[model samples]
Target: MTRYRTTDGKEDMKQKVHWFGAAAIPLAFMNGLFFGGYALRKIRQYWEGGPMD
Candidate 1:
């Protein structure tokens, strides 16, 4: 397999990765927070011997 090198392609890929990282960082953080809160809520319910909603 032969791969061609081009500055344009490299720059495009870099830009895409940069954009993805910018979006992904906050998204990942929010996802963690959402799940963490959900877990805590479930834990509290279990500790209280209440029904899970």
Candidate 2:
């Protein structure tokens, strides 16, 4: 079996985030907030294509 390291596995996400394909910022933001931010965390998760995104 082949095992992937952190550096080896982040390329896909790095490219996605770097390209700013419209879904990156929102998903990142929601993830960050939900993980450790404010009450709006839940709200952010559902606010796709929103102004903040």
Candidate 3:
């Protein structure tokens, strides 16, 4: 047996962003930059046929 969730039209669906949520934008950006650089380095190594170390 499986249960399903149903939402009524009368349910409140408002969303609010707290002050801390705004701070995550910069953190997410920095994370993206860090990972992007790491990925680029790996890609360069692959192009050069070098071992991933």
**Candidate with best TM-score:** 1
- Estimate, for each residue in 1-53, the C-alpha lDDT of model 2 and write its tens digit: 22234655653322222345566779898998777765565568667545463
Q: How far is candidate 1 from the true structure (C-alpha RMSD, Å)?
A: 6.7
Stretches of candidate 1 above 4 Å error?
Answer: 1-17
Poorest stretch of ten by lDDT in candidate 2: 11-20
**lDDT by residue for model 3 (1-53), tens:** 22333486453445455556677889899999999999999999999899767
Clashing pairs for model 2 are none
Residue 15's lDDT in candidate 3: 49
Clash pairs, model 3 backbone: none
lDDT of 1 by residue, 1-53 (tens): 22444766653223233466568879999999999999999999999999767
Query: Candidates 1 and 2: which is better by lDDT?
Result: 1
On a 0 to 100 scale, what is the lDDT of residue 5 in model 2? 41
lDDT of 3: 0.75
